[model samples]
Structures are given as C-alpha cells and as structure tokens.
Target: MQKEIKAIIDGWRNYFQGSSSVGLTLAQERAVICSTCEYAKYGKHAAILPDAQIGNIQGYYCGVCKCPLSTAVRSSGYECPKNKW
Candidate 1:
C-alpha cells in the first residue's frame, strides 16, 4: 500500500518536473516483465468492470496493487512489487 502511494507521488513529482517517463526501450522491457507477471492481470474483466471496454483494458495491470502496468512501466522510478523488473 505504501509503495503504491509512493509511486503515485513520485509520478506526480516527475510529471511536474517535466521528465516523468522512461525511454522506449526501458518501458518496453518493463512491459514485457509485467505481461508475464502472475500478479499482472490483463483486460477490463480483471479490473472488475466486465461490461466496460476501456482502451487500456488490453494492457496489463498488477492484480495485487491494482496499478496500471502501462503507466507504471513508463515511469523510470517505479519498481515492480514482486521485483519482476
């Protein structure tokens, strides 16, 4: 829980600092890790909105912490909860 909060805060801080995201290669690497993670859930059904079809539903997310994997992976300072990245 604390980690999630810290990640969010850091994300916001980075955003305001004008350098929030990582390079494409690093982000892609993180994506690959998140995609294969057991705790990473794909699709909207995993988020409990079975009827909705959000664009990011196709992206992966951490099932345990409920953080959006796409956004999380793009943030260089963010770390995986399970250390998969």
Candidate 2:
C-alpha cells in the first residue's frame, strides 16, 4: 500500500519535471507492453484507473496489481506484478 503511494509520487514528479510522466523511454516501453496486455482491464473497472491514458490507448487498470497503468508505468517504485516489465 505504501509502495503504491511512493510510485505515484515518483511518477508525478517525473511528469512535472519533464515532458513525460513515465520518463522518456522505459515508461513508454512499459506502456507498450501494457497496451496489449489482457490484464489491462477497463470500462466497468474504470473507477480504479480513471482519467488514464497509455501511449495510444484510453484508460485501464492492471488486473494483477489493480492500479492505474498511466501512473504505475511512470513510477520506478511499482514493478509489473507479473514481472513483464
């Protein structure tokens, strides 16, 4: 739980500090992987990952971690629950 908060902090800090929230490369890479992931659920799961955007896709929540990918991908604190990233 605490780790999630730290990841959010790091992600936002990276965003405000630069043009990209997930940094330049790694974050984008993570997003790319997540874009095709079946676990990146949305629609009815909107509340958990609201206002989300990843690469070209809309919003989504990681079915494994159950967190917003937009924010989670940006952070170094949060790792892919499935270790894909």
Candidate 3:
C-alpha cells in the first residue's frame, strides 16, 4: 500500500515537473465553450461538444441545467459577436 501511494505521488510529481507533457480538457485549456452542459446558444452546438482535443475547441455542459455554455459567458472574459447565421 505504501509503495502504491509512493508511485502515485511520484507520477504526479513528474507530471508537474514538465518532464512529460500533460493534456488539458476543454475546460482547462479554455478551448471549449461549455464545460458542464451541452447547450450552445450561438450554434447548433459549441465546438468540440463531446470530446476535447488539443488544438481544437472544447465544449462544456452543465450537469444541473444540462445545457452547453460558452467559455466567454462562463469566464466572463469576452463576448464574441453573434454569427449572422
């Protein structure tokens, strides 16, 4: 049990050390609109609604509301202009 715990700790330390690369979820990378739900207000769905990919946008869904959210709205950083379509 001690060895297992030590191994886990070492793995975490390595991850943080930047010796290896770590992937980020849409929520963590700021690539997706919604990190909790699936409701995309501007489009049929926010980019990367299901799976989060590096170099690609991610979508978040609201577990409570079951709706997709825009990162801009969630973060309150910036509001992208609505698409004409």
Candidate 4:
C-alpha cells in the first residue's frame, strides 16, 4: 500500500514538472536582480551581474526580496524557484 501511494505521488510530481513553465527573460531577470541586489539596501536598484552580464539571473542578493521575486515570477507565468523539483 505504501509503495502504491508513493508511485502515485511520484507520477504527479513528474507530470507537474514537465508541464510547468521555467526560466526568465533578460529584462525580467534584471528586475529580479535589482529587487534583491545587496546594493538595494543602500538605495541601489540596478542589476550589475559581471559574469553573465545580460542573461538569466542566478546569484545571491537580499533575502528581503525573495518573497516578492517569487510572486512576480509566478505572475509572469513561471514557476517559483523553490518549486523547481
């Protein structure tokens, strides 16, 4: 019985993963970085990622903006970063 239930759960998880939207656009990704930028606390709203320069954002920033960023991503038709499993 436990194995059967686990199989059903695994199937649903896989289905959702395949059907979900992911990733980000250049502009939106920048906005994401800005909102969480470390400099944001000191009044900076610009995204200055030196590595990728201009692409999908994936790095450290203010934890304060995590919730809002997650919401924005969801509203923009993408899955939350924490839900990518």
TM-score of each: 0.60, 0.68, 0.24, 0.22
lDDT of all predictions: 0.59, 0.68, 0.33, 0.35
lDDT per residue as tens, model 4, 1-85: 6654443344334323432123334335544655455533322212332223222232333344332232233232323344422
Candidate 2: tens digits of C-alpha lDDT, residues 6-65: 887886666445545446677778888988898888644344434333443346768886
Pairs clashing within candidate 2: none
RMSD in angstroms, all models?
Answer: 6.0, 3.7, 14.9, 11.5
Better of 1 and 4 by TM-score: 1
Error of 4 at 1 (Å): 0.2
Off by over 4 Å in 4: 19-85
Ranking according to TM-score, highest score first: 2, 1, 3, 4
Mark the regions of model 2 whose C-alpha exceeds 4 Å error after superposition. Answer: 12-22, 44-54
Model 1: per-residue Cα lDDT over 26-66, one tens digit each: 66666667766788777554444221222333355679767
Instruction: Please give the TM-score that candidate 4 achieves against the real structure.
Output: 0.22
Q: After superposition, how far is residue 20 of candidate 1 from its true place, in Å?
A: 5.7
- Error in Å for residue 76 of model 4: 32
Clashes of each: 0, 0, 16, 0
- Order the numbered candidates by lDDT, best leading: 2, 1, 4, 3
lDDT-better candidate, 1 vs 3: 1
